[model samples]
Target: MRASLVPGVALLGSYPAKSLPRDLVAGLVLTALLVPQGMAYAELAGLPAITGLYTSILCLLGYAFFGPSRILVLGPDSSLGPMIAATVLPLVAADGDPRRAVALGSALALMTGAMALLAGIGKLGFIADLISKPTMIGYMNGLALTILVGQLPKLFGFSVDASGLFAELIGFAAEVAGGATVPAALAIGLGGLVVILALQRVLPKIPAVLVVVVLSIGAAAVLGLGDRGVDLVGPLPQGFPPLTIPYITLSDVPLLLAGALGITVVSLADTISTATAFAARTGQRVDGNKEMIGIGAANVAAGLFQGFPVSTSGSRTAVAEQAGARTQVTGLVGAGAISLILLLAPGLLRNLPQPTLAAVVIAASLSLADIPGTVRLYRLRRTEFSLSIAAFVGVVWLGVLPGIAVAVALSIGNVFRRAWWPYQTVLGRVPGIPGYHDVRSYPHAERLPGCPIYRFDAPVFFANARTFREQILALAESQPRPAWIIVAAEPITDVDTTAADMLRDLDLDLELNKKGVDIVFAEMKDPVRRKIDQYELTATIDPAHFYPTLDAAITAFRTTAGAEWGPAPAEEAS
Candidate 1:
């Protein structure tokens, strides 16, 4: 039925010939964005601008061959720049040898690719949810601030040797105060920034970035700005690098591996989100695992050719879509165009100003921020907002790598915390409403004369076994205590060994047994009930106390304990 079992094979087999011309035109438009952005993002990552082009070319071709989504574009992205720099730059020597840096960048890309490939093969695409939306928003906000700050010195035509965000900020201020600013550099950079912002706001459909870059280059050439001390891109290296596996010191593997895992996670998240957004418009389905495999292949291709790791660029993908791209042919065409430029016209952008590249990166950084998302989180939920703020502080106060670690740890901790002390409420019959409802939501709801129905929102596990026991004990000890306590257990999807043991101990506890307050379970899942029996908790918990529904439990309690419907005592009403 199929000519090839290879990934993305069907893309070509099912290709519509009518789309060829459109793909070609879209590819040319995409190339205009890719050349400048690829170079800028590479410089942002502390690599040579030429390596960015190599990365763009190889990744585009690789994804065309392996990526699942036809319209999703892969390339060097602004958000990944600081992360790549954090991982690869420290490994470089103090002199910052460009060759060593490229080698290390390539090695990092390979490690990232291998890890992502294995993850995809293992179907671990669910790890993308490891960072909650609030935390992710905070991380991006911090990254945006970090990038914007890091590029200021380049925009002003100087360099800050200081490390850390605070140190860089201080160093930048000192440089500006010490008259280290280059007038020509500032003029071009700010002028380009203003032009880009103006055009983007006034005519969003237009390619303002391409326009500003072209005008900047023309101005530099006409005014002889390079002679006036404004730095220029000069000339890019000609042609693509030969395909060869990257190498690094054996001692560096552990560090690089750690960074690679983080990089893979972030890249996977970015890819999935971008793919989903585009697939919605194109009426396609998303496959996260396949996306991972695709990105892994792209990174491998880039690594073999002296390039760093990359991620999805939403802006560039948007450009291709607007230019009427229909399939991977657009990506192939763009790759071929870049290859031809590298071979035939490497110096076409020689007059492009360095500050203009900074402007491009800074513009990308601005787009990376999700300030409105952060504010909305704060307004909607304060607890989640705290997690967001913590993530932000982690990125700003700590470094990028550590920030990622901190955000992950916080995400996991928040999950654990909610489970350890999940929401507990008393349920009762709300007049004419439904089966049951939280009494707190309706204070006048009817309740059993001597028993209370309680609901716990999480599974019973060791982490919250003690909290569950204590809350039950408190209810049993209250004055005018009920003869029976009913647990609405539908939400308790699991009961681990420790929690089962805790339940048995509560049954045997002197306080509950002495007071003649019996505990009963209602609407528990069958699997959890089996687990309780397996743990032998039914021995002390009483097998007869289990009921199929809350209604059954109430009927049994009323029959056995002779309880009647009435409002709870004043203090326990809600």
Candidate 2:
């Protein structure tokens, strides 16, 4: 093994070393979790249960080799399952020709993996942050609800049409009413759900899924659920997944590209969030780009190894961490365990009941609801809450892709609205406070002596550059036409060429004919100032107008423009 690959304290640069026995114990405990979840999530993805085993094996091995997290467990996540199936089923007949569909799905995985890897190398992982928290919450909640509603038929031994969520609901209602809800299948599913939920609440450390699996399989075996008409998993393939490549045609590539990009974005978002959460728990710093690379490698391996795309399984990772897992060694062990099960107990898996798996999926989906979180967000910010609801409704009514698109567009629109109508506040000094603040916020606050300083708390890009200039002009139109306007550049971290040009033009307006107020910048960083200098803005605007600090800018304005100002006027009685 490479020295860097070794599990040691020095590998993370800082953090304590964990004992080998602890990691082994954690691996064994989490393996129990990984096996059942792998199968359940594969079912969720509309793939054969055995594919879940294959997915578990390859993704674990991949993460062990390349993932930076000491305890992250990668496998088929419930969140991505419906996405994969929805993306693939429309393009081809899922049941009629599994081979072609599988190939296309694999191709999508490979493309997504390649995209994530490229993004990581390009240091563009920050793009994941563009997926606002509200959007994610809404998306997850909608997906979970869809999965729950869609799985009801399977759980109740009925069938559902694949038209859409509404169609499925109608079909389920028509087919699964009253006595049609098979006692055996419904009982098994509901029983499993109740058991998992109960165990999760009571004995979370006991690997509830594994316990439920063993009990349900045992009950099915004893009661002979097959003879009573309950569907079974049937026999699984014994051995490791054979090496395979997805066959992609030009036409298929175009069809799958949109879905592939969606998967890539979702996968990156999920992995980064998981990595950051675990890193926080362990007091380790996560490298977002590195996390992306690891996730990409895992998906690539999954695609090549007859497996579906994978992401960091949050439940399993938490289990591993809670069980004392220390390093990637735990993942390696878990991988070996999954492979062993695939090789040895392929026949035993045949007796696994479909409803039991559905229950497991339903239970997992329940956690994704975040009702309390949604309520809190609604209380805190009505606009954000509305956006989240819009996303949820879009996902439920339209589809996942359209929902994401709407959510992103809405977020971008909100940002533009905030930038265009930038809020301006007049500064005033408070009785007990030393510095001036917004007069609107602090009624007793006093303004700075001469210059009226205003801060536009956003990057001055093309979207808002012209608006920023207009706002500055409006401020200059005040009765006395303030002698100086110091723009607090702290929040304006970036300035594009358009903005620099506008500033230069504004400086000309102030200097040439005094058509506008003189503009000065405070707390401008070197990179921004460099751009300004490169644009020859200094030719029209004085270099002395830029100050390194707000205080310095105030001092200069007091010296240069203080004589033109008068004392504060009394407020008019309301």
The backbone clash count of each candidate, in order, is: 0, 4
- Write one digit per residue (lDDT tens) for candidate 2, span 123-221: 888867766788778888888888898889989976676667888888889886556777898888889999999999999878889888998899899
- For model 2 the local lDDT of residue 348 reads 73
Cand. 1 Cα-lDDT: 0.89
Error of 2 at 119 (Å): 2.2
Cα error, residue 555 of model 2, in Å, equals 4.7
* Per-model TM-score versus the true fold: 0.97, 0.90
Error of 2 at 260 (Å): 2.0
Worst 10 residues of 1 by lDDT: 1-10
